[model samples]
Target: MKKSLLFLFGLFSLWSFALINFKGVPVFSIVEAQQKTQPLTGKKVKTEKPVTIKRNAVTTVLPVAQYPLPKGSQWSYLDNGSDQGATGWNQLTFDNSAWAAGAAPLGYGDPVATTISYGPSSTNKYITSYFSRDIQIDLNTIGDEVEFGLRRDDGAIVYVNGVEVFRNNMPAGTVNYLTNSASIVDGADEKRYFTTYLPKSVFQNGVNRVSVEIHNRDQTSSDISFDMYIRDKAPDYVCVEDHIACFTSIAPTSQTPVMIIPQEHRFQMLFKQGTAYMDGSGTVPGNHDFTGYIPSVGATSSALGHLSVNHENNPGGVSIVDIALNQDPANPLWVVNNSRKVDFSNTALVKTERNCSGGVTPWGTIITAEEATTSGDSNGDGYQDVGWLVEINPATASVVNYGNGTHEKLWAMGRMNHENIVVSADGVTAYYGEDGGTHCTYKFVANTPNNFSSGTLYVLKMDLALSNDEPSSATATWVQVPNTTQAERNNVTTAAAALGGTNFNGVEDCEISPIDGKIYFASKGKNRVYRFKDNGTTVSEFETFVGGKSYPITTANGVVTENWADGNDNLAFDDHGNLWVVQDGGLNYIWVVRPNHTQSDPKVMIHSSMPAGSEPTGLTFTPDYKYGFFSVQHPSGSNQAQPDATQSNVIFNASAALVFSNKDFLGQQQNLSTNPVVALNSEIQVYPNPTKGLVTLSLNEEADKNLKIEVYDFLGRKVYAKETQTTGINQKETIDLSGFKGEQLVIIQVETGDTKQIYKVLKKDN
Candidate 1:
């Protein structure tokens, strides 16, 4: 005969049973156990396999509970500056009825709910302050571990149930009331919270006493602060995939449009405003605007790079973040390795303001545009120097030095309400637009290739008058502007108008088509995106590429008809020549226009709609085109949380930077069939023409034989040569041109078996 022994665990009673013989020996079974559902909670409980155990064996484990000590909780503190020594004042049995009670955080100097006395004199303040709180705990309902969130200045020591549990900033060995902190606490570290974990065994079954002693670095320390909270050591958020629709028919009015994406894609938040940096600096700034991604040198992984994010404020700042991909294959995630604020005060410009959209140079540097002009001249450079383009080294989070004791503001770029700038592949020409009410599109040609210190500025002058309300076309010439003097550069808008420069209403962004090498810019006030073919001196075939007309948008719900509203702001291109338009006005939608889109029959799709009271800005892609980054600027505080259920309690309601990509799109080569620049013969291609320091040679799949690449300068002098076997796919070979000087023409020859191709490339000095 056999007897059954049963056991139930915790509040969510899970049942398990074992069979025992009459002689008291347990019998194990391998049969599958069934699951039972609790009617009250509607939660399923899974049973474990029957095992051999004692007849009266029992086990208890409970789920983690909510935080026990919240901010501003009342605490009994002693601030009389007397040494309590090792007298059992921290024990539960100790009498503390005479101690003064106050709501935390309680200290001096910084903002606090309750301020405590700092002792006799300002020069001779007290060294330590004592704080204690009582909390009840149940052994059967508590978790295995607890975490303490402590905010202290200088140092602190914590005790649980009259036993030492953690020490921070204090010296090693026996600690007493006279102990001093290891170092001084200053700046942002004073307000930062430090966390520590301890086993729940330190707590008691009934009432538990928690005591903490905060010590200053020295007796004369100017400031002191203390606050603490306790919670179970379990993560509040459980990561889950957000499965949203690919498209929605509802427009954003009272609330933000629901984020929809392709079924295979995933969206993730990389950084949020007000998050503390890993280096103990202040939290990330708000009003996130321009986001630029710079891939690390020689980085084999597509996800390893640096991000330069601009804060659009009165005194603007740029934050540089070093990021990498996590190792989890099932759930790939991007992690921030380090982050800090870019130091612009060390430069001659002192500080930047209203940093809007920017561009990345081919030689690895970021150029941030100052979108506003100010009357104050911090640099005293005869004219207001706040509206020039500034360059930065994202890797070091510092402004580039010109080696002349000055810093990275390009004075030659002229002063205006700059919206965005785009550099050509050759690194010689740059196009930017003015975002004022009546402004003109401008161009810059560097005198020394990649060096933008001194450049010639020009404004667009169209031969035919272009219509602002309907589809129109025209030819234009770049008229040279008198930008040599500070006074002339200060008033470029007025001078350009005098020279008959075509006035565009709110020209917001400029981008070069990677497929056909054409220039495209968006006029926000006119609601049109105009494209132009750049010939050496003049532009031809200038016409409206998108907007200024009605188009059909396909969605998962159904086909929807819409017209371009007054919102087209920023523009970016993908590997497939698809244009991604980020909006700052109207419905604040992110629109994607295919390469084959025509004026009569446009192929456009709505990708995303920003949250209420917010506009999407700064959309940039990685080198492999596998990931994209953008910012949601100043979203409504009441907007719904995203991705996870616990996010509702988090701070994503503020501004944030996000990254999105699909697993199927990673590690794929560029599509050469649709790109005219790379599909001439579907064989070999050399770019960027007019090399600065290095040039890349790309070979197609048909080039499977032994490949020979040779570069010759003017007068037929062999400058560089290499021979290797081709992988027959998207194989790239880099040719170094740093040895050459000045601007000169060079011929790059590629021979694969019998097929040979020669490209006339211009090699420019760095």
Candidate 2:
């Protein structure tokens, strides 16, 4: 999510003149299409071959498929938080409503917030603060061209060899609009470059400090969300065929490298019907049941559905906290009846995060974040409190908490609403999303990094590009905090500062294209998607896609965008050069957006939607690309007493599991559809996909002389690239894939007038 294209009006308010009429799928039926095909007036329908434009211009349009689900093949419904029992449980309740109950030592159950913070984040005594740290990497493996990105609210800064790569410092408050809330390092903001280049030598063998600074104005006080990590591979490092999918049934036969969600570590994902469930159980691949508590309208599979609960953000019946928010056992995970059986009677508990969503670690573990501070007492009543980041190990089936500095600090981070984690290509820096009306995105730079305790944290900020003169969209800059104890860490929390704050739609899930170091994110609050390039600077600018609700849509400028509303959760690119977007199950439907990245005027080539209740969560492509996996966690528990099935669609209405093909989104490969029609012909094509090294093709074959080779994004915007000579036929050419990331697309178009052709290619394992 980026900044709003509108300017500000009042102080606590900014007003956009007109609601720009921005835009907008479906299934099939044999009886439907045939009826239309049947000649109403059989007048020998003259078949028209028309003109033979032998794919004159081959344009490669990456095909999108439904995000895969975890193909656990057989996941036993566990009840315990350990690895042992995987069966039924008698109605059981701990019979306690106290805060941080149980005999466990309260807090995040980790080292107290002494002095050091996660990353190099600074803390403000008055209201804001910062804490910073460093992560040393081997530049040898990570070429000098290493690049990544960060997401923050008001501002941020990333440096390599002390050379600034990213920076931004927006205000506080919050922006709900997607385009207005997201900030990438390139294009949009001068200080933030999307594709920043860091030479291999930039990182010495020993230690390197990755510092961060944040400011907090009076409004909501101060707190920063920052993540720092490093990876040696590019965004496309995981080839389409190699990158595991969103859903399938993988856990049972998961060949995809594993990551653990340590015991006690809070972890949750939308499975079916947008229902939320947590695995409070010890570890993964265990005997003890990981199935813990489920908060919903009710906790039954068929009978009463998991309707709603009155939580902080979710009022009425609609739910918000589907996933757990913390990892400490002291917190009661007791809840239930949302899975296969409809029974809120038995009070089963699970783990959770601190508002910040949990993330899968490179080591195959799940890291749950607790958005609370060390001293707990977010209201500042002076009561002992707790906040920290916890880790859940799948192998060991255990959980550990990494507490925060202060309660207000934890609460300021947005009270257990942590939404995303964008890890670095090498595991040096990690970007975080603070989902809230007055929250900012942040980064965590681990000290020993992989070992934890070392590094700094930085906030996200962007310049107001659309509003030149207005201070709201001022120069793109990323403010820095020497330590987490600084005086101002909420600098970017302003509606204007953080490009409209976290309003219309706040940043939910963020991902980067390893190939070009481009960043993409979903703004659930806004129902939009955005892009950011890496050019070396604080991230602020973002390209966008206004994918309409459940429909294939294109921008007036010709570029295609993805769409969603409260369309929360994950994002990823497949080996086929396609971008897959996942929405919250409860959002009413499933949508897949396919944009012709190679087209000059790219349009959404495909769009598909499914019925309600199919709550989709987590996504992964199998290593073989033959299968995919995602988690459709069934709903559980109800605020009221237990309700039987006759009541309503209850929890099951929010539960589901899905698995579709690579072309599922386009309805091309899939046979079933709510409205499947011979969709309009797309202006895209590609070749030698899953190639070992080079790939080539042309936009139009009519050109007798030359073809221009370039790479574009979903919005049809070209990024840093070069041209090459094609063979006599439409300028045949080859590009070195050694420098590129994962399976990506390269466009070759004819220079001869308006002639064009498109081709799709894949760069993969040799």
Cα displacement (angstroms), candidate 2, residue 693, comes to: 9.3
* Residue-by-residue lDDT tens digits, candidate 2, 1-766: 1233222222112112211111110112211211222111122211121110101111111111111100000010111112111211111111111101011000111211111122232232222222223344554545445544332323444444344445545334431111121322221222111234355565556455443333222223233233223333233311121122322211111111111111111222223333334433211110010111122232222111122211111110112112222222233221232322111111111222232344544544444444333333334443223333444443333343345432122222222245556666566666666556344555556665453443565555543323111112112333432333322222223322334332324666666664456666776654556555433345533445433243324322443433334565566555444566656533423333343331112223222232222334445443233333344332332212212112222233333332233332211122323222212012223456767765544332333434454554322334335544333433444555545566555433323233333334455665
In model 1, residue pairs whose N, Cα or C atoms come closer than 3 Å (at least 3 residues apart or on different chains), thus clashing, are: none
In candidate 1, what are the lDDT values of residues 486-526, reduced to their tens digit? 79877777788899888888888999987678999998887
Pick the lDDT winner. 1
Q: Distance (Å) between predicted and true CA of 170, model 1?
A: 90
Error of 2 at 686 (Å): 20
User: Stretches of candidate 1 above 4 Å error?
Assistant: 1-258, 299-301, 468-472, 644-651, 663-766
Error of 2 at 79 (Å): 71
Q: C-alpha displacement of 20 in model 1, angstroms?
A: 99
